[model samples]
Target: MQEISRVFDAERIQWASATASGHTVNSAEAYQATGVSDLLPRSPRQLVFVECDVLGLEPAEVCDHHNPGDPGYDRQPQEYLQGSSLGQVLSLLGKEPTHEQRIIAAADHCLTHAYRGECPGVDPAELADWRERSRAARFGLTHEEIQMRIRIATKALERAERIKVG
Candidate 1:
């Protein structure tokens, strides 16, 4: 555990492989044994984070849609997330947002492509392609595997002392 955690903690990124899982379609090993792949979005927070980064926007910019008091708050995504079919499912499962909420609250809005629907200065087709890719990436992963990746990432974040944000 320490060895694997060390890899995740290093400034330079490293990759490892899981022994074997019947689910993976490529490389026979989950990415660094974390079960992540180029094909998947990991989680909503990661998906939004990457999208925000690609668009030269911060998660806060995307998340402000969640905060009613913010000047730039959009309200639409928040309302939609709260009322969408996915939202109802999450509620039914009693799984309220955790990492996703913190990530959005830190930035102040919904940063997802689906949530945003259309973004200015961004090619809608490109965003749609990314969304599709994310869905595909997660295809082979089981729910448990996905959650395991999130838990490991959360642990790494908790252990981080200086994230070197610019």
Candidate 2:
């Protein structure tokens, strides 16, 4: 749990009972507080335009694990963004690669890292052993600082996910 907090606020999340989907989700104000919430989605509507097509599901599920809030969860947009985030990550690194590797390798790290500070020991190889260690570092930021980072990263992550590669 510390490792999760190192990158996010587990407390910031709660089961959104007012959901159309079965997976745990959030209202926008609620999500913006999480820091782990998707990104820059002023309304769920903007999510589709960014190609987060699966967002048609619901915001609540973003938090739910097996019991998912409404729809359990769909793999479409999630998989789609997995493919897309990989392409961009590789292109930026001047490489060509498979999608799964990219998601496992980078998308996750990008999701955890906050804007206000560096995530100490951010080694990709360390990720496997990281969970326990992360619990201690929880939020390298103060509360107000974390909120600011959330605002900045929301737009940034959204744009990153929305990127269209040529």
Candidate 3:
């Protein structure tokens, strides 16, 4: 969400609850939450719906991989599955996925599988550290703690050496 906001220079970042299935949010609900009305004429103020179904919007406006029949889901490469949304958004923004972003995609899909060579050239220790951080961030963290974690991770990445193996 933060990445999307940064790319679009979005004025606001809002969170919307997923629908009954817990896999996706209703497009209408998401738009409402974001204060984007489909009825309004399209303008420079675009609403790029990430990981949500498109109810009354064009396919180009959405970046998701959860619904099989939806254009967003169909556009994703089969191997990436759940992890494709971020890459899709990055591609749409004319940016390549960074190594860390690739790691994030692989981790989101399946960390264990990713460690077993799916995400080649990435260090397992780094992956494990990310897993720990993810687990820690999943519950009971205040905003300050989250910010602290982000800062620590950023600093660690800056100091870390990249290692690639065949």
Evaluated with TM-score, which candidate comes out highest?
3
Top candidate (lDDT): 3
Q: lDDT by residue for model 1 over 1-166, one digit each (tens)?
A: 2222232345233322222232322432322233322343344532222111122223322211223443334444435434232332234335554433322222223446433543323344444444344444658765556557667998999998975778
Model 3 per-residue lDDT tens digits across residues 1-166: 4445454454233333334333334545543343332244445455566765444544346666556753345432235433466666777666777777766666654557667765554566777666666656676675467667778999999999988998
Decide which is better by TM-score, 1 or 2: 1
Query: What ranges in model 3 sit over 4 Å off?
Result: 1-47, 70-83, 138-166
- TM-scores across all candidates? 0.23, 0.20, 0.52
Candidate 1 yields a Cα-based lDDT of 0.36
Each prediction's RMSD to truth: 19.5, 18.4, 11.0
Whole-model lDDT for model 2 versus the true structure? 0.34
lDDT of each: 0.36, 0.34, 0.56
TM-score of 3: 0.52
Q: Distance (Å) between predicted and true CA of 158, model 1?
A: 47
Misplaced by over 4 Å in model 1 are 1-64, 70-72, 75-118, 141-166
Q: Between prediction 1 and prediction 3, which has the larger lDDT?
A: 3
